[model samples]
Target: MIVVTTPTGRIGRHVLGHVLDGAEKVRVIVRDPERLPAPVRERVDVVRGSHDDPGVVAEALAGAGSVFWLIPPNPRAQSVQDHVIDFVRPLCTAIGDHGVERVVAVSTLGRGITRNAGLVSATYAMDDLIESTGVHYRSLCPPAFMENLLSQVETIRSRGTFFAPISADRRFLTCAVRDIAATAAALLLDGSWTGQDSVPIVGPDLLSYEEMAQIMTEVLQRPVRFQQISGEAFTAALRRAGVSEAWAGGGAAIMAATDRGTYVAEAGSPGPTAPTSFRQWCEEVLEPAVG
Candidate 1:
């Protein structure tokens, strides 16, 4: 059986769908079973609780061979590092106790660049903790999510503008969540690969926010613009939106690292590059969200 965590989340739901289509016996650990579609609940073994709980994870991993892991964000958590550790420790223990063979997890790019990055650094730490367990692991590393723009959909619709902490001309890789999920599902369904490695799920396009604005303008047929803001201002905006101080500060650190080009793929890097271009993502995903 293949166990899936966060089965109703944006990327997890897609991963679960693909796994089911591959005819894998699936089990899901979820906090609220009702949140899942009725058909999904009927299809998988439902362990109704947070995966961070030892009992919950132990129950979910019983007789499971492979797993899809993702840590859901907690905006109100006191510290980002502590929050990540709380979730990872239990899984590390359960992986050994249950004798699971392979694991696939959602992680960020930039492994060797620096450690001062908030979420990026924390996720890299997670990779290490899981690897220390000596199980077969694949870290699905991707840059910024294009769906992050959905947070500003209302602003784009009303003001024809979106804001970011990066420079207007600073280009970076961004991947669609669907592509990330597709890669994860493929790894989970196949049992051939072994050992540990990181897969960079980079999009085919390297785009700046200004260029993204141009594409949005054409795709949405609106006069959209990109407004560059200071990292402090971006953090403050997140704080005002009611996230904890640590969460807000982490957001700033991520943008600061992005501005430093931490997510840029290395020259001739191996592994699969995602095929979704920015223009195609805009036309298909962003335009629909804006509408």
Candidate 2:
């Protein structure tokens, strides 16, 4: 049996879809089972409650051979570190009790190099805590998501401008969430691999926000451009967008670190690289969001 957390979310739903396409026995932990599409409802068993709840996870993981885990964002939480760790503590016990054989989790980049990286640091902590359980684990590490651009879709369409806290010319590698989901789905289906490892889901292009704007301009037929903002201003913007003050401040810290080149991919990767290109993401994802 395979258990999936956050099964209705953007990436998780896709993971569930790919797994369901195969012959694995599947169950899902969801806050609201009704949010699942009707077809998904008919196909899978579900435990309705937050996955972090001990009972929910225990019930979901019962007799399950593999687990696809994702910590759903809590933008309103008072503390980023506490939020992620608190959720993981329960699951660590459950994984041990259930004797699950394999685990796949979504984590971030900058594992060893990034310090005081706010939420990213918390994700690294999560990896440590889960791995200590001795479950065969795979950490799906991706940099900034290409879907983040969708947050600026309205501005890109109406004003042809988007905002960022990072400088225009600093290059960073990003991955499409589709690629991340694809990796998770593939791992969940294969029970042969053992031990712990990090899978870096890096897209093929290294791009700056300026290059991203140029691509969006060409793909969406709009003169999109990046406008840099102050760190505090970016935090305030995040708050205005509905994230709590603490979460927004952590986000600001991540932006500051990114601008300082803390997130630049190593000259040659030491892990797996995904196949999607930045321009391909623009044409497929950004263009549709703009429309």
Give the distance in Å from residue 183's predicted Cα in candidate 2 to where it truly belongs: 0.6
Instruction: For each candidate, give its TM-score against the true structure.
Output: 0.98, 0.97
Candidate 1 — number of clashing residue pairs?
0
Per-residue lDDT, model 2, residue 77, is: 95
Cα-based lDDT for every prediction: 0.92, 0.88
Please count the clashing residue pairs in each candidate, in the order shown. 0, 0
**Against the true structure, whose lDDT is highest?**
1
Q: Which stretches of candidate 1 lie over 4 Å from their true place?
A: 266-272
> For model 2, how does the per-residue alpha-carbon lDDT over 139-193 read when each residue is reduced to its tens digit?
9999888888788888888999999899999988888999999999999999899
Q: Which sections of candidate 2 miss by over 4 Å?
A: 268-272
Error of model 1, residue 236, in angstroms:
1.0
